[model samples]
Target: MKLPEINTATPYAGLSPDLVLDAVSHCGLWPDGRLLALNSYENRVWQVGLEETAPVIAKFYRPGRWSDAAIEEEHAFALELAAAELPVVAPLVFDGQTLRQHEGFRYALTPRRGGRAPSLESTTQLEWLGRLIARIHSVGSRQPFVHRGRVDRATLMQAPMQAVLASTLLPASLQANYRSAAQRLDDAVAMRLEAIGPVRQLRLHGDCHPGNVLWTDEGPHFVDLDDARMGPAVQDLWMLAGDERALNALLDGYTQMREFDDTERALIPALRAMRQMHYAGWIAARWHDPAFPAAFPFAAESRWWEQHIADLHELADGL
Candidate 1:
């Protein structure tokens, strides 16, 4: 269950402006300022520009880590959304192979959006967001792991939670809460995963967290479809529920797009817990990976999830 921990900071820790500029030049692109690198759990992204007027981003991925199928899937999803008139960062031309392997590392290029990343700061805007959510969900659900079939919720939760429960390198409080929360929701979790309900799985911008959203003149532009997968309609909703006020605001806009039915509504709290628990567990298992920061946002999310688990349980039992 444990994977090698990576030094999440290694990519940016020693990034000097001169060195980044050098990388820009090496890539045959003019460096307007310096290459801005953003490293996350799975990928490395850098913003480089050929012109001072507007910057284009090129994301260099770790070679062989993401399968060619996944890259293709993401491209398809981005184009799908774009075709619907959604303003997402368009995919620019790339190297013949998306899996750029060199020095045991991989990389790729994708266009950067013109405007800034979207803020979850407004409620009224969320109503607009809800509409987007509805449109996204309505697109057509295709199973992520298996490309040939329609994806249902059961297929999504089954493996991830099993892997999550196996992770151990978590903080004591967070780990404790995870175990406790799992124990409390055992039945509902099992039922949800086992009974297998109707989930309108369409392509999703899998990791639709605030970090992946781009704010533009047109509206919200979804940037990272890396986590794109076939899953539940409100899976994104639970992820956004990390903050209640923002959740409410986004829901207001999202509902205007397509409202959550009563069952989907009731499952929100549990789904929120599911997202945190899954990621928390994943982080714990790899806490010691050389690629990770000894202390990273995963640990922070674990702590938050543990506390929220208790609160959600109290509310659930009361109901």
Candidate 2:
């Protein structure tokens, strides 16, 4: 049967179940049933349900946004993360390989993992999420487990700035529907970008914006491992540090998973700055979209960057 469509994409506009099922049949992991819903987040994400069989997720890599090798790496990372036995989204393999080429793009299959997104107001549940982050960071980087090969902090800081500059120079809105907010936001991100600095680098959930997360029975279950990269432990903490209770609660919660000292606790600022920089970059990149908010999309206002900078009365606070 024809599969449901995947949403949020420009690349997979031509994809259908023909190439997908054809490829899956060859790989031997095709679920023996009809289609379900289209994943609004994944351009290639589709739900396949079979007769009395477990549901499985199918995804195809859209061209341009990602290369075959990158998708290949993502699937491999999911497999390794699964083997590490962390409560993570595990990828199902075909012919022992997680990624395969289909419809002129790459594709992979993984079991349908279930979980709800934790409510922002649920302090206890949020703390539980923190504990999960600590556990992920605790896993020492092993071969084939490094989040991303080249996404270090310095690199992290540059991307958002570039996207902002590009946004600023773009042509004006149509029919004179001027976007004052977008233009002002472009400036805010530009001013905020330079003040960011280094943090305690480790493995980061590269894009930890709240949307990619989920709430599971065990606690918080992280999804969309697309941007998982090697960077700082605090990288995950940046967007989270604004709420003091959540911040402190997370620090306390992490200990349940692994050990960190006062020195590490103090590193929250630098890590947060890096996160803001990336966030500012994202706003700048998508400023053209009407949904893009002027006061930064996911985190606090740009002034938070300045406030963070001023909070430092002394030299860099951590080792």
Candidate 3:
């Protein structure tokens, strides 16, 4: 079967090595040709060694993903966090702008930062991470995003489900079952949000899973704010803790810096449900990209759909 047409093949199909080198030079930096592709699926990122300076990370934003305004808002947010002496990797100000462009691609250059993945198993570590996130949230709440989006059901649940249904990836035999399960999940998520009415929405690190945080001897610092959005503070905290103990530890550290709304804890299950649906939709929408097939081979199998439907039903049952 011919795969569905994707807008562009994985957003980096034409990002050749020389193109990256020229982009660096356009920014007035001399490249040493020692380029290492970083592990990023949403955008193309590379660590390029410089001629007379240390290596720097070049992130080429995926076309059609975020408008230039939204991306600049992200860059400004990072710079704001850094100005507060928070451990965040902000983009370098080249010429006069943090956002730069080259050969039809919008990109930014950040000084290469090195650190190991954080160990979430330690309570102390969790607490430390909690404090940092709280600090981020504190800054995030100070102002609202003019261009970035929010973490809500319309974008998270409805859009993803629509994409999956429109795609050819779902088998004809399983489509009905998947649709029913997903619709039920959508209803449950809506009800959950209604029950937790009027939670405070603030600027958030929208995707705060451990992978986004880099840890060194000094402490933890966030590396990616690409998913930043306006949402409840808990949206940043819930993903850090799987169990009550860990959650409490994270909260323990967070409270030390800023007051957290305990009521937001109730929104965790709802947020998780939305994420589960959003992930499947994201995969379906990107299935036409070559990288999607290689990284998500299971998505092509009937067994995966079976599990996915069942999981959706389980989420509905809980809600």
Candidate 4:
């Protein structure tokens, strides 16, 4: 399927320091004149200091990425998870509204929660996270997201493949290799998914990588539902599992709350491949965004594309 061309124009060019401060002020919060930019490339996230209280995190959505309804679905999911006593950082409802707009930029505020990355090496931590995720799935299974996306070939694999092909960064010489590798990976993914038939799909903490998980003395708390969508339960688990031991540990905790379909294990390899394709495509699609080029300078190098193509082939073979 032909996808829309990536927007090459700089979308955040007009998001000045004054505009950020003014946006916060418009939300009825007095800024203390201290704004620390968070490590986010997809959206503009800032730790905004307040006059008397702890700083709050203000996130400005990327232009044209998600519709208002889709974003609201994300916010609603976070709020639902928080209300269930889960440690999800939900957007604050100001004037009975979680989604707000200022000067054409949509944004939201959430109270800042600080913590370091979770120790994935520790079995205890993985099991703990497993239980938390199972509980999240329990709530998520109650209903479906009306506006969010699904984890599938078209979105994760095909769309990304198109993005990479469309980008000028992929050297003309390497284009054929990249295309062949991507196609093989896509076919392999489709075959694997087809063999699995159908499985349960539910709301998920779509981007459940360690970076999105913060750990304190208490336990793990999930943040950044920006990629939250509908998918198999394993979509939330595979990224956190590094090896057989970690996967077992997570499942041990997970089974305590929800009965996982053992068949979902087969989807992991395919999902991993899809994620790889998606990452390259994401960088390509967002290359026009100034931060992407600066953060992923390697993507501009021909050598990087060569390695990526080789990796795609390897992944396809593994599948």
Estimate, for each residue in 1-319, the C-alpha lDDT of model 3 and write its tens digit.
3322334655667779999999999999999999999988788899999998999999988888898899999999999999999999999998789998776788999998888888878999999988998999989989999899999999899999999999888888999999999999999888888887988888988999988888889988888899999999999988889899999999999999999989888899989999999999999998877778898999989899899999999999988
List candidate 1 segments past 4 Å from native. Answer: 1-33, 51-53, 62-65, 95-99, 114-123, 141-186, 192-196, 241-262, 297-319
Best by lDDT: 4
The reply for model 3, stretches above 4 Å from the true place, is 1-10
Residues 146-240 of candidate 4: C-alpha lDDT, one tens digit per residue: 89889999999999999999999999999899999999999999999999999999999999999999998888799999999999999999999
Question: Which stretches in model 2 have alpha-carbon errors above 4 Å?
Answer: 1-10, 30-33, 37-42, 67-69, 140-157, 164-169, 172-199, 240-242, 261-319
Q: Comparing 1 and 2 by TM-score, which wins?
A: 1
Displacement of the residue 39 alpha carbon in candidate 2, Å: 4.2
Local accuracy of candidate 2 as per-residue lDDT tens digits, 1-55: 3334443333455566666666666666545657765654334577776446687
Candidate 2 Cα deviation (angstroms), residue 85: 2.3
- Residue 277's lDDT in candidate 1: 45
> All candidates' TM-scores?
0.69, 0.67, 0.96, 0.97
Candidate 1 accuracy as lDDT: 0.57
- Candidate 4, position 207, lDDT: 91
Candidate 2: worst 10 consecutive residues by lDDT? 310-319
Local accuracy of candidate 1 as per-residue lDDT tens digits, 243-306: 7787677677677766565456555655654554445445544544545545465544555555
| Whole-model lDDT values for every prediction | 0.57, 0.56, 0.90, 0.92
lDDT (0-100) at residue 290 of candidate 2? 36
